[model samples]
Each structure stands twice: as structure tokens, then as C-alpha cells.
Target chain A: MEVLFTFLPKTAHQEKLEKEFPDVDFHFTYKEKSRLPSVDILVTYGEDITEEDISKAEKLKWIMVASAGVEKMPLQAMKERGIAVSNVKGIHKTPMAESVLAHLLALKRSLPFIYESQQNNQWNRKTGSSELFGSTALILGPGAIGSEIGRLLQAFGVRTIGCNRSGSAADYMDEMTSFEDILMKLPEADLIISVVPSTKETKHMLKKEHFEAMKKDAIFMNFGRGDLVEDQILLEALENGAVGYAVLDVFEQEPLPPEHPYWSMKNVVISPHASSHSKKYVDRALDIFIPNLHKWLSEDLNPTNLVNLEKGY
Target chain B: MEVLFTFLPKTAHQEKLEKEFPDVDFHFTYKEKSRLPSVDILVTYGEDITEEDISKAEKLKWIMVASAGVEKMPLQAMKERGIAVSNVKGIHKTPMAESVLAHLLALKRSLPFIYESQQNNQWNRKTGSSELFGSTALILGPGAIGSEIGRLLQAFGVRTIGCNRSGSAADYMDEMTSFEDILMKLPEADLIISVVPSTKETKHMLKKEHFEAMKKDAIFMNFGRGDLVEDQILLEALENGAVGYAVLDVFEQEPLPPEHPYWSMKNVVISPHASSHSKKYVDRALDIFIPNLHKWLSEDLNPTNLVNLEKGY
Candidate 1:
């Protein structure tokens, strides 16, 4: 069997894989296009997978993404090829939540203002600093990542209201509500965080009506798919003071076009979609890969966390 | 009863107090010096309390300082006059802990670098990012504030070692050790946070030797007393790569001076001695004040969190 791994290979990991499947020809390079026809498995973190590679790979039975989202993959081609797919989802639960908190605390504590003061060699105590202690947070898409975020916030004494498709209670949330009721529940939260994924139904789910329904001083944060929010509506909300602050980790476009208004906005906090980027990412990714690899080898057990292509999740 | 308050009066709180103690004369201004002579009780957050004022308040039986530190107060006079002195010590636990987490997450996720990129209107994804998960944190002074910080860090899957005088295990710490063992244990930590107070033994507790003992890539944060750390030694560590990053909220000299190298250092993050700051400070202050007021009115038990003039804690 020929296995093609797209990420940089670690010595220990390569040795471990070789020891497990002694007869397998393991190739760890993205540029090995000539070997595509004989490749039995394709492992990727979304840099080199393309429709052409998928078409050329006649023996490819499995394609694994080492990140949560498989949106970067040529899903249509893989789906038609009857290729099994799985993504590393649960690993990013804590790191992304931690990243959300990093910005939320900075915004509340005015750490950026403090940084500006430090640049001028001044020691200034920024007044009117807020606390998460008594504030209420509305968490959209209360799945793994969102629930983890709520759990962390719960430690800070913030009341978390989980919003999902079903109005079912989650472990860390103080209460639960349906996503359909988001606008009605909007004004109640002092902090709003959305972790909704990108889908046909979820794209552009939160916009002008929802932002306008929020409290004037409410903080809006999106660590979810950028498509879940409308960029123009968010910009208008910030300018109109409907949203007190917006901490955006993902954008409708990557690199944010260099001249976007969000880059220079006073009330905006921007990060280059690196929230889930952790040194431990590869190790955690391996945890998913090893398990699913065994399942694929057995050929009888269905792979866990396999992406449902028709549902487009 | 005559009560002299040195803080500006909030109308709602004043009304609530007056409604309960109708016969008591409450003078809520520092400039009301004529009433100082007859002040039976003094409430201050440290602007109006002076040795001369203490001498004039012959009838002052109780003096409540609405802050954590009593180093600025005339302890000798208060102890000599047989007046009860209390300072709000435990209220800053959550806010300071929050502040510590803010910087800890920021450092681990490269928030300072993100801010610089944002300043240039750039969207560069910083690689080789770190996480608090599976990291070891050594917390100095595991009392009210330090323990709270440990609890929050524990939620992020960090192994926290608590340091105290007795070396007894604290609630949130995975292990406990004495302050004497800090040097030996220093090399084990990826993160070191100090919440130790300004005391005779604690003054200049951390210096060049301690920073040199730490892991080369370790992050050093101080939300403790400025005197506990030697700033010159800290600067040397940062300059020589002995310390990977230094987030200092307090300094030996603050408004941290215009000429200090820390203000210009690339590896430094500074906040102006405002770790304990929060918009709910007054409400938390009232939590201490109201309790002490009732205790005084009852005239039975001594006020809680009293400052020991002799031991100076």
C-alpha cells in the first residue's frame, strides 16, 4: 500500500508508522505527483490536495484532513470517488477557546491601550475596565469548541447561554436556546461569541438584524467560520456603536486584503485565523490519524468522525 | 456616630446606607476637614489618610482602608492609638487572576506580535504557537489571589505548583512547595507568576539568579508587589534570552519612567500597576466596607482581614 502524507514528517512519528505497517510504502512529501496513481491513502493538512490529484489517484481509498474544517478539500471530487474522509476536530476545542479568551480579556482590560502607552514609555491605568464576573455570554453553536469556550468562561463567573439547532442544555452553559431565537436573545448578553460552522444554512446567519438587536455595549466575537457573519453589517455595527467591540479571528477573506476597514478600526481586534495554531497540533492530529488508519485497515468498522459529504459538514 | 469617607459617594449606595443608619452622620468627602476631629470611623482608599489626620481623629475607633496594601498607612500610630485597621485583601483575587490569564494567553498565542501586525495593517499568521495545555506553571504566594489564578489555569489543563511559606498544598495547585525551594523548582516551570506581597522577607525576592535558573523559553509574569522583583535583573534576563518573555504589571518604580529599557524592549509586556482594577471595584469595596461597618456597629467581634501593624501583613 502506498501512503502519501502532506505535512512535514517527524522522525519518531515516521518510525512509529513504519513499525506498524512494515510492508507499506510511506511517502511524506506534497510534491510527489508521479506517485499519485499508486497512492492508497492521502493524509493532508490542506496545502496540496487538489481535484487533479484526486482524479489521478486510482487506488486512493481514504483522504484524511488534519484540521477541523475540510472546506479546503476538493470535497465534490472525493465524494464522487467514494473516498472515505475524516477531520481532526476535537483537538482544537481547547486551543481555539483559549484564543477567544485571549482577545476577550484584552478587549475588556484595554491591554491594547496599555501596549500603546508602553510604546510611548508611559504608565497609564486605563479607567472603566470591565470584568467577565457578572457579564452574560451568548454562545452560538454549542458544540465541542463552543461548549469548551463556555466552560472556560464559566470559571470567570460569566453566565453562558448556549445556542444550538436544538434548544438542549449543554454542560457548561447556564441556559440553552435555539439558534432561531438568536435575535430575541441578543439584547440579554453583554458578550456574544459565535462558533457556528460554515454550511448552506449557517452562511450569513448573523447579520444586521442580530447586531441591531444586541445591546449597545455588547461585545461581539466570531471564532467560527467567517461566512457565518456579514462583513459589511459588522463594519456598520461598529461604526454605529451597535456593537461595542468586535474581535475577529476569521474574515470573509484571508490576509484581509491589506486595505480593509477592520485593520484600522478603533473597536476591532484582528488575528490572522491562527486561533487553533498550536505546537501540539501535529501530535493531536496524529491521535485522530492513527485511530482512523486502524479502522481503514480493518475494512469492517466505519471510521469515526467521517464527514458526511451530502450534509456538507 | 460620625463616619468620614474619603471616596466619592455614589447616590444609590449613600441612600441605602442612610436608609439603614438614619441617625448616623455620614460625611462622604475628604475635603470636609472640619468634621475630621469628631470622626468616629474613617473609610479611605488612601488619599486622605495621614499621620496628622490620625492624630486629629481622637475619637477614631476604626479605620478601614479600601485597598489591599497598608504599606502606605501609618501603622505605628494606628496601633498606638488602639484603633482597628482593616484593608480589603481578598477582593482582588478574581480580577488579578483574570489579568494574569490575559497576559499568559497573550504570550502563549503571540498577541503582542499580532498587535504589531495589526498596527502595520498586516495579517500574518504567526507559526510555532504554544498552548497552556500540558504546560507547568509555578505560582508564588498561593493565597487569595494566587490560588484563584491557579484555579483558572487548572481549567486549561496546566499543572500548577503552588508556593507558600509552610509548603502546604493549596486548593488549585497540583503540588505544593516552600518558597525556599523556588530556585530548584524554577528550572521545571514553563510559566512563573508571582503574586507575593511587599514585605520585609519578600522584598527583592526575585533577581538575576532566579531568572537565570528558569527554563530558557519560560515566560515570567509579575502581578505581585513591584519590590518583589529587581527590574534591572529582569531586563538583563530579557536582553540575554534568559527569559523568553516578561509581562510586568507592577514595577519597583512606576509610572515605569520614560528612560526604562523595559518600555522599549521587544520581549516585554507592561501594564500600569492596575491588575486589581475593575469597574466593579466599588461594589467589591462595599462588600468589605458594609461587613466591617456592621461588625463595628455590633461592637462584638474584631473586623475580618485586619492589618497586623506589628507583622505588617
Candidate 2:
């Protein structure tokens, strides 16, 4: 099998793959698009693959995505070409969940203000703080990352509610509701975290109306796709004091423009799309790919994380 | 029964106490030390009672301190007078533990740096982050707060080691050691939190030698007493880059002087002794005090958190 890794694998990672699967031609180079010509397997991390590369790869049988979301990839073309797609799903649960808790805790503890006080050489004991215990949290996705966040929050005695498309039973939800029923839950959540994927059904899921429903002191965090939340509406809500604090790790635009008010908002934490970027990232990505590689070699090509191209997630 | 509330109880808190205990005369005043003259039951939060006040209180039988630490109070005088003392112990567990986690996670994830970048309108994704999963933490004073912090970090898969004076078993600690054996464990800790009391033996416990033994990139936090850690020694370590980050919630000299070098250190987070100040402070303190009130009235007069004068904690 001829494989091309679009993600620049670390030397150890590349060596491990090469050593484990000696029969496979593992061509791991991020810059060389020419290697895509005769590749049978391509691994990427939601990178936008060129149509030219897709057309040239007549021998391509599978595409492995090294991310939970596969929305940015050419899903339609890949589907038309009969390419089996498997993504590194559910692997971001630990890092993403940790990031959410970290940011939320920082806001409640007045940590940013405390740091500012430190900078000013002021001993500020007046800044009031609240604990995670007895707080209500609403998780918009409730999939791998959301459920894991809920579980972690539960350890702190936070009551967790989850919203899902089908209102199905979710692992760590104290209560589950349909997406349509989520707006009412907005007023109930002390914390509102949206980890919903980017799709037609979820596009602009959280706007002014949804933000308005949340408690004035509610902390909102978006570690999901930027398309799921309207930035302008969120900004207005923040300005109007309808939302207390917003930790935006994902934005409508990458490397959010300098003109954006979010950068200047004292109540907002602009995390530069690195919430899931951990030192152990390469190892986590491999946990998904290596296991599936074994299954693929045995002709059981349908991996556990096989993506449904029509769903666009 | 006569009572003097020196902590300035909120009207609501005063009303609740008065409503619950009709027989007790609640002398609620933060100022006017004249109120202490006829007090039989004194309610305070580690405020020192002068020799004059002690001599004036002819009927003073019990002092209810609304904090875990009673070091500032006249312990020797109270002991000599055969006056009973009670403190609200273990009430700070939740808030203190949460504060420790908040600061540690912020350092590991570069939340402070990210907030700085947001202020500068810079999109910097290169500020690397380390995950808590594979890290190890060493907690000093493995009492209620220490154990609670250990349990919470366990959910994040952090290996927790605890140090206690007696080398006694503590909950949620993967390993427990004595104060003497702590030096060896210093180099292994990614995070070191000190919650040890400000006792004679514990004063300057974490000095230059301890800081030198710690991992170069280790994050150190002092949420215990200021006296337990030597400020000058810590400043030297921070300057020398021996300590990666220092979250000092307590200082030897509070309102830590404007000219203090800690104010100028980028690697330090001057926490201003507010780590345990939560909005729910009144309610949590009452959790310990109210029950003791009932016990005192029944003539049993035995409080769960009665302080041993010699220990000074």
C-alpha cells in the first residue's frame, strides 16, 4: 500500500509507522504534493486537498483524516471517487475537555484580573470569584469531547445538561434535550459550551436569541467549528452584558483580524485555535491511525471512525 | 448568651443567625471594639484580640474563628485564660483546591500568555501547551484542601504525591511522604502546591534549597500561609529560572509591597491572597459555625474545629 501523510509527522512517528508496516510505502512529506500522484492511501488533518491531486490519484483507495472534523476536505469529490474515509475522531476529548475547563475556571477565579493586578503590583482581594461546584453547565455537542467535559465537570459537582440533534441519551448528561429545545436551557446554564460540529443543520446554531437567553453572568465557550456560532451576535451579546465571558478558541476567521473587537474585549479570551494542540498530539493522532491501519490491511476497510461523506462532518 | 460578630456579618447573615437563635444576643459589628467588653461568645475570622480586650472580656467563654488558620489570634493568652476556641476548618477546601487547579492549568495551557496576545491583537499559535494527563503534582499540607485538589487532578490523569508533617496517609495521594522526605520528590513534580499552615516548624519550609531541587520547568503555588515560603528565596529562584511559574496567593508581607520583585516577574502570578475568597464565602463559613453554635448552646460546648493553642493553626 502506498500512503502519503500530509501532516508532517515527527521523526519518531514516521519511523514507528515505517518500522511497523514494512510492506506499506509510507511517504510522509507535508510540502511535496507530487507524492500524491500514485498514492493509494492519503492521511491529512482537515487540510483542503487540491482537486488536481484528487484527479491524479487514480490508485487512491482511502483517505485518513487526522482530525475530528472532516468538513474542510473535498468530501463530495472523495465520495465520487469511491475513497474510504476514516478520521481521528474522539481523540480530542482529553485535550479539548481540559482546555474548556481551564478557560472556564480561569474566568470564574478572576485569574486574568489577578494577573493584571500582579502586573500593576496591586494586591487585589476585592475581585469576587465563584466555584464550579453547584454551577449548571449546558454542553451543545455532547459527543466525545462534550461528554468528556461533562464527566470532568461532574468531578467538580457541576450539573451538566447536553443538547443533541436527536435528544438521544448521552453518557455524562444530567439531562438531554433536542437542539430545538436548547434555547430554554440557555437561561439555566451558568456555563454554555458549544462543541457542535460544522454542518448545514448546525450552521449559525448560536446567535443573538440564543445568547440573549443565557444568564447575564453565564460563561460561554466555543471549541467547536466557528460556523456553529455567529461572532457578530456573540459580540453584541457581550457588549450588552447578556453574556458575561466568552472564550473563543475557534473563530469565523482564522488568525482573527486585528480589527475584530474580540481581540480588545476584556471579557473575552481569544485563544488562537490551539486548544487541542498539545505536546502529545502526534501520539494521540497515531492511536487512531495505527489501529485502523491493521484493520485496513486485513481487508476490513470500514474503520470505527469511518466518515459518512453525505453528512459533511 | 452574648455574641460579638467581628467579621461584619451581612444583614441577611445576621438575620438568619438571629432568627435561628432567639436566646443569643448577636452583637454584629466589624468596628467598635467596645462591643467586646460584655461578650460571652466571640465570632471572628483570625483577627487578633488585644491583651486589653482579653482582660475586658470577663464573661468571654468561647471564640468562634471563621477561618482555618488561627495563627494571628492570641493563642497563648486564650490558652492561659482557659478560653475555648473554634475555627471553621475544611470550609476552604473547595475554593482553595479550585484556585490551585485554576492557576496550574492556566500556566500549563498558557492562558495568561494567550490573554496577553489577545490584548495585543496578535494571533500566535506557537505558544506551546503541556497537558496535565502525563504530569505529576506534589501537594504540601495534604489536609482537606490538598486531598480535594489531588482528587480533582486525578480525573485529569495527573499523578499526585502528597507531603504531610506526620507522613500520615492522605486521601487521593498516589504516594505520601514526610516533610523531611519532600526534597527528593521536588525534582519529580511538574506542579508543587503548598497549603501547609504557618507554624513555627513550617515557617520558611520551602526555601532556596527546596526551590533549587525542583524541576526547572515546575510551576509552584503557595495558597497556604505566607510564612511557610521565604519570599526572598522564591524571588531568587524565579529570577534564576529555577522555578518556571510561581502562583503566590499568600505572601510573607501581604499587599506585597509595590517595590517587591515578584510584581515585576513575568514568570510569577501574584494571587493577592484571594484564592479562597468565593462569592459563597458566607454560606460556606456558616456551614462550620452554625452546627457548632447548636452544640455550644446545648451546654456540650464542644466544637469540631476547636484549635489547640500550642499548634498555632
Candidate 3:
């Protein structure tokens, strides 16, 4: 069988893959040229993969996404072509969760202001410094990534509230609330972090009214899909002091155009969607992918993170 | 009985004190001009209290320090006069520990750089973003504040090494080592945090050799006493990359002079000694002080955090 990687892996990883599957034809490139039609398996980050690429790959039976988010991929086209898709889902929990805490602690401790003060060689102690202890956090989605974030936050004595579709109890969360009932819980949360996946139903989940329901000084963070809230609604909330601050790792548009108001907003922390970028990321992804590859090769069982095309996770 | 408060308590706290001790006179002022001679108990932050002030207070039986640090207090005079001393020691753990995490996370996530990038409206994703997981942190003086910091860091999957006088096992630490043996563990620590008290034995604990023994990329933090490490030694380490970064909340001099080299260094983050400054500081300090006051008034018992005059904690 032929395996094609649309993104360049580390030289050591390429060598390891070649050694592990000596019988398989392995092709690695950002631009996988003539072998596209003959590719039996495709591994990608799901960013550069398009509907046209799916149509050209006649021999492709399965698409393995190295990253958790599959929203950027052509799900409909893949579904129509009867292509099986599996993604490394829980791999981002560690780095992404750390990123959440990094932003939360930085903002809460007034590090941004402190750093700015350092630039002017000023030793200003009136930083409006605060602690995370006894504060309430509302984590939307509360899946693998959110639960990890909750676990870390709870360690610092933060009361974590996880929100999901059914309001099922999640590990490390003090309370659980349904997505439908979030409005009732908004005012009590000092922090609100969204880690929900992208989908039609999940799109624009937080609107202007949701921000209005929150406490005036509440910090809103979108580490999930950018479409979770309309950019304009969040901007208005921050601009009006309805939401005190925003720690954004995702945007409605990738690279978040230079003209975007968020870049200039003092209350907004832009992370350039780099929260999930870790040196160990590829290794962790392969830990899931390689084992799944073995299971797929030896048996007919589906891989662990097999995505449902209609749900689009 | 007369009690002198050199620091202002909250209006509500003042009312509470007056209501609780109606028979006792409560004097509040920065300059307790005429009351010093009549004062039975002095409640101060210990900064302005001098040996002369202690000598003037002929009626002073106990000094109720409202802060953790007693290094600046007139301990020699208080001890000579047979006056007892107590401070709100453990009250700083929550805010101080949270501050440690804030600085560590900020540096690890390249937040200072990210904030600078935001100023230029640059969407820079090449931030050397890292996670705190599976790293080693050497906590010097794992007492109340250090242990709390260790507990929080442990929850993030960091292996904590607590160093103290005896090197005895500490809560939340994976390993323990004596203050003398820290040089051996320095190379293994990705983060070194000093929370040791200021004493003759503790002063200049981290000198040129200690910094030389540390990992080249290790981050050093001084949240303890400014005298724990000589400023010149730390400056040399940072200048030579012997220490990768320094997060300082304490310095040899208060309001670290504008001419200080650390202020200009890109790798150093100066916090203006505000890590322990919390909105709830006075409340937490009062929580310890009020109960102690009741015990002292009803029964001639020593307060919970009664300091050993000779040991200077």
C-alpha cells in the first residue's frame, strides 16, 4: 500500500516511518506531485487538502488528519467519495490546556501591564493584580481539551463550570451546565473559555446577548473555533467593557488581517492560533496515528478518532 | 487596652474591630504620635517600625505584624524589650504562589514577546511556546508559599524539587534536597524559584557559583527576599546566558532603580514586588490577626505565627 504525507515530518520521523513499514511505499511532501492518483492513504494537517485533491486521489481509501480540528477540510466531498477520516483528537489537550492556563494566569496577574511598565523602566506596583483562587471559570465544550484546562485551573482553587450539549458531568469541573442553559450561568463566571468544535449548529454559539449576560469584568477566551462567536459581537462587548478581556487563539479569518480591530485592542491577547503548537506535537500525533495505522493494517477495525462527516468534528 | 494600627484597615474592618472590642481603644495612623507610649499592641506592616519606635512603646507587649516579612522589623529591640512578635505568614501563599505560576507561564509561552508583537499589530506565530509538563522545578525554601507553588506546578505535571535547610520531604514535591546540595540539582531544573526567608544564613544563597551550576536555559525567579541572591551575580548570569530568564518580584533595592541593567534586559521580567499584592490581602491578613487577637485578649497565648526573634522568620 502507498502512504502519502502532505506535510513534511521531521527527518527522524520520516526515517522511523520508512523503517517501520518497509513494504509500503512512503511519499512525503508539501506538494505530493504525480503519486496523488495512486495514493492509498493520505496523512495531512487538513489545511492544504481541498475538494479537488480528494477527487484526484482515486486510490485513497482513508484520510488521517494529524491535527484535532477537521473544519478546514472538505468534509462533504470526502463523505461523497466514501473516504474514511480519522484525526488525532486528544493529542492537543496538554499544550492547549497549558496555553489556556498561560493566558489566564498572565492576564489575572497583570503580566501584560507589568511587561509594558518594564519597557518604560517603571516599577509600578499598582497593577490591579489579582489571583485565580476562588474565581469561577465557565468552560464551554468541556471535552478533552477543556477538561484538561479545568483540571489545571481547579488545582489553583478555581471553581470550574463545564458546558456541553447534555450538561453531563466532566472530570475536574465543579458544576456542569447545558449549552442551552449557559445564559443562566454567565453572570457568575469570572472567566469563560470556549473549546467547542466547529459545526453548523455550533457556529456563532455565543452572540451579543451572551456577552451581555456575563459579568462586566468577565474574561472571555476563544481557544476553539473562531466562528463560536461572531467577531463583531465580541468586539462590541470588549469595546463597551461588557467583557473585560479576551484571549483569542483562533479567529474568523486565519492570520487575522492587519486591519482587524483586535490587534489594537489593549484588552485582547492575540496568540496567532499557536496555542496547540508544541515541539512534542508531532510525536504525540504519531503516537496515536502509528498505533491506529497498525490496527487498520492488521484488522478491519476503525481508528479511534474516526470522524462522523455529518457532525464535522 | 490601647491598640495602635500604623496601616489603614478597610472601613468595614475598622468598624468590625471597634464593634468587637468596644472596651479597648483602637488608634489608627501612619504616625501614632502620642499613642506610642500608651500602646499595648502595635499592628503594622513592619516597614516603618524602627528600634526607636519599639523603645518608645513602653507599654508594648506584642507586635502584630500585618505582613509575612519581618526582616525590616526592629526585631533586636523587640527581643531586648521582651516583646512578643507574630506575623501573618501563611496568608501570602495563595497570591504569591499564583504569581509564581503567572511569571513561569508567561515566560514559557513567550507572552512578553507576544504582547510586544501585539503592540506592532504583528501576527507572529513563531513564538517559542512551551508547556510546563514533565519539567523539573527546584523550589528553594519549600515552606508555606513554596509548597503551595509546588502543589500548583505539580498539577501541571512538573516534577518539583523542594530545597530547604534540612532537605526533608515536603508536600507536593517529588524530591527534596538540602540547601547545601542545591548545586547538584541545579543542572536538572528548568525553573528555579527562591522563596527562602531573609536571614544571615540565607542571604546571598545563590551566588556566582550557584548560577554557574544551573542549566544554561533555566529560568530563575526570586519571590523570596531580595538578599537571597546578590544583584550583581544575577546580572552577570543573565548577561552571559548562564541563566536564560529571570522573573524578579524582589530586588536588593526597593523600586529597582531606573539605571539598573535588569530593566533593559530582554530576558528579565520585573514585577515591582507586587506578586503578593492581592485585593484580598488585608482580608486574609485580618483573618489570621482577628482570631489571634481574640486568643491573646481572652487568654495570654502566643499567636499562631509567633516569630523566633533570633531565627528572624
| Highest-scoring model, TM-score | 3
TM-score of each: 0.96, 0.97, 0.98
Give interface RMSD, every candidate, in order.
Answer: 1.3, 0.9, 0.9
Across A138-220, the per-residue lDDT of candidate 1 in tens digits comes to 99988899999999999989999999888888879999999788888899999999888788878999879899999999989
In model 1, the runs with Cα more than 4 Å from the true position are A10-16, B31-34
Q: Comparing 2 and 3 by DockQ, which wins?
A: 3
Candidate 2 colliding pairs: none
The docking category that best describes candidate 1 is: medium
Which candidate, 1 or 3, would have the higher lDDT against the true structure?
3
List, residue by residue over B16-79, the lDDT tens digit for candidate 1: 7787778789888845666778999888885467888889988998888888878777888889
TM-score of chain B of each: 0.95, 0.97, 0.98
Which ten residues in a row are the worst by lDDT in model 1 chain A? A295-304
In Å, residue B198's CA in model 2 sits off its true spot by 1.3
True contacts kept of 1: 0.72
Question: Which residue pairs of candidate 3 clash?
Answer: none
Check candidate 1 and list the clashing pairs: none
For model 2, state the Cα shift of residue A31 in Å. Answer: 3.6
